[model samples]
Target: MKCSAGRKVFKDFLKCEYSEENILFWLACEDLKRESNPEVVEEKARLIYEDFISILSPKEVSLDSRVREIINNKMVEPTSHTFDEAQLQIYTLMHRDSYPRFVNSQMYRKLAQLPVPNRKGSIA
Candidate 1:
């Protein structure tokens, strides 16, 4: 399946598993990394950390102690790459763990059978 199609499937799977925050955090990090303004980068990085890395956050992602420590240190002066390690970890976790299950899910099977759309938006 295409990466974008797989991403949509995986996101639905994450929602079913009540762990959509993982993908959300990864997407946020991607957006932060594309920022041209240093101030915006710092602000977005801190927000992402607070939302996904802080232990107190309800949406906190599971991360190893080493990565957690790295993030904590970087939070003092947050940068766009501050969450790179953590984001990679989450992405790997989802790809290795959730992705297989998603590919085999009944939902995916049903979606795969649907007719593709044409440029005019009609099913082909």
Candidate 2:
């Protein structure tokens, strides 16, 4: 909680893909690992955290109860694909804008589009 609380106000910057709450939860883990053990963090712990996060695919993220209900769920317009087409479609609305602004805007939901949850703690 040290790292999370330390950057709590700056938490707003860490969330671009989803609700700030849940994204903060995941990003906080990075801070946890780094601050917990800075020496080995870059080698062992970071890779482990990333691999674990990768297991949570976009489809899984889209299906998250919080994501569907809170983020303004609209009909997914059924697609034959196993992946979530709805989330991607909504995310693409600002695909052409500047990287930080468009990606970080509240208008966009990061949980769906970002390929990975990669908020490496700035503890260094």
Candidate 3:
């Protein structure tokens, strides 16, 4: 999640699991937090709701009824932090559930084999 390539690989794995929406929702929440413009925040929040909160969306993420209610209420006054609780729930779900599978995946095995860069900028 810290780097683009790593995120891409994880996203691919999530896609295979048919749960890519989890990461997508997390990324959207991250972007929303960085946004400063009120209009843009509102727009992004609406898009997030439509993409990951709405039951009708194909990319909807798994969320509990309590969290869903919180989100529904927050939509009335959207802010960058509006999805904070939902984001945390999804993040916890990914960390506790998907992360273990990800660590055991072939993709992660290949990634683990790659050489790391040393402080001198040479591969270690």
Candidate 4:
């Protein structure tokens, strides 16, 4: 789940389920947190909201009304941490709803069968 390869596989599986937005939003939030410039933070936050939080977005992730309200309030003056709570909610939702399915998916099974690479980059 932490490794890039594993995340890609999971993302692919999610795409098949039409829920790749969960991982995409999570990744966006991660990128947002790494930002230092306030302007970048605001821009990224707005894009994230327009892309994933808005009801009109095709890729919108499901969120409760409370989280939505919080996000709306934060949008007045966005920051790197603006989406922290919403990110957590989406993370929990994916963990509880999508993760199990991903684990059981053929994509995961195939990944599980792949040989592990050693520090030298050769299959171990």
Candidate 5:
């Protein structure tokens, strides 16, 4: 999330918690991938949005540009673990939210795979 977008989102979330706008954002995000189920997706978004606040409440305005610049400039091996930690927060929240399905679209044995990533392991 960009700082401006985060500002708007947090302001809106504060106003209504889980308003239609928030649900719409969730729905739109869910529409983007070979995605997780609704409950899992909701949990994922909730976790990321929550993590965004720690930076926000600190009034870390400069972090927005720094985060944006780092995100824009990326190489797999050369990046710092701060980025890794933040990335893992996203992954952890997502993993904590999503799971491999118990059944398939065709009753096959396995429909999706959840690879255990080498992540920074977020506790929140």
Candidate 6:
């Protein structure tokens, strides 16, 4: 199965499970890490933390005490990689817990049969 197709199917599966915030948080961190402007990086980092890291947030992603403490300390001076550890943890969680289920899901089965596009933009 194509990685992109699998990711989309997995995200859909996550939504069905009401745990889409995990992927959303991970994607947001990816976007934030691509930022080149210091001010924008700081702003995005804070927003990501408030949206996904804060306990008060309804969209909070599950993070361990060590990663949480690291993020809390790094939040004082936010950087592009401020959420690296947390993001990795979430990624691992999805890869280990959700990915296998997604692979076996009917949605994934259907998606896997679809033709994928080639580099030339034609279906392969």
Top TM-score model: 4
In candidate 3 the C-alpha lDDT for residue 116 amounts to 49
Per-prediction TM-score = 0.84, 0.20, 0.88, 0.89, 0.21, 0.85
Residue runs of model 2 more than 4 Å from their true location after superposition = 1-124
Question: For candidate 4, lDDT tens digit of each residue in 1-124?
Answer: 5789889988999999999999999999999999999999999999999999999999999999999999999999999999999999999999999999888665776678855556797666
> Ten-residue segment with the worst summed lDDT in candidate 3?
114-123
Worst 10 residues of 1 by lDDT: 109-118
Point out the worst 10-residue segment of candidate 2 by lDDT.
74-83
Give the runs in model 1 whose Cα sits over 4 Å from its true position: 1-5, 114-124
Best by lDDT: 3
Summed over model 3, clashes come to: 0
| Alpha-carbon local distance difference test for all models | 0.85, 0.35, 0.93, 0.92, 0.35, 0.87
The Cα error of candidate 3 at residue 64, in Å, is: 0.6
Error of 5 at 34 (Å): 25
Ranked by TM-score, top first: 4, 3, 6, 1, 5, 2
lDDT per residue as tens, model 1, 12-115 = 88899888998988889889989979899888988898898889999999999999999989988888899999999999998898778776666775788755
Error of 3 at 114 (Å): 8.8
Error of 6 at 30 (Å): 0.6
On the 0 to 100 scale, the lDDT of residue 70 in model 2 is 31
Q: Total clashes, candidate 5? A: 0
Score residue 76 of candidate 2 by CA lDDT.
Answer: 25
Query: Candidate 6's error at 17, in angstroms?
Result: 0.8
* Cα TM-score of candidate 4: 0.89
Residues 1-124, candidate 2: write the lDDT tens digits: 2455434533454344343433333443344434434444334333322332234533222234444443233212211221233234323432333234534544333433444333683322
TM-score of 6: 0.85
Where does model 5 exceed 4 Å of error?
Answer: 1-82, 100-124
Per-residue lDDT of candidate 6, residues 1-124 (tens digit): 1366556767889999889999999889889889989999999999998899999999999999999999999999999999999999999998899888777666765667755556797766
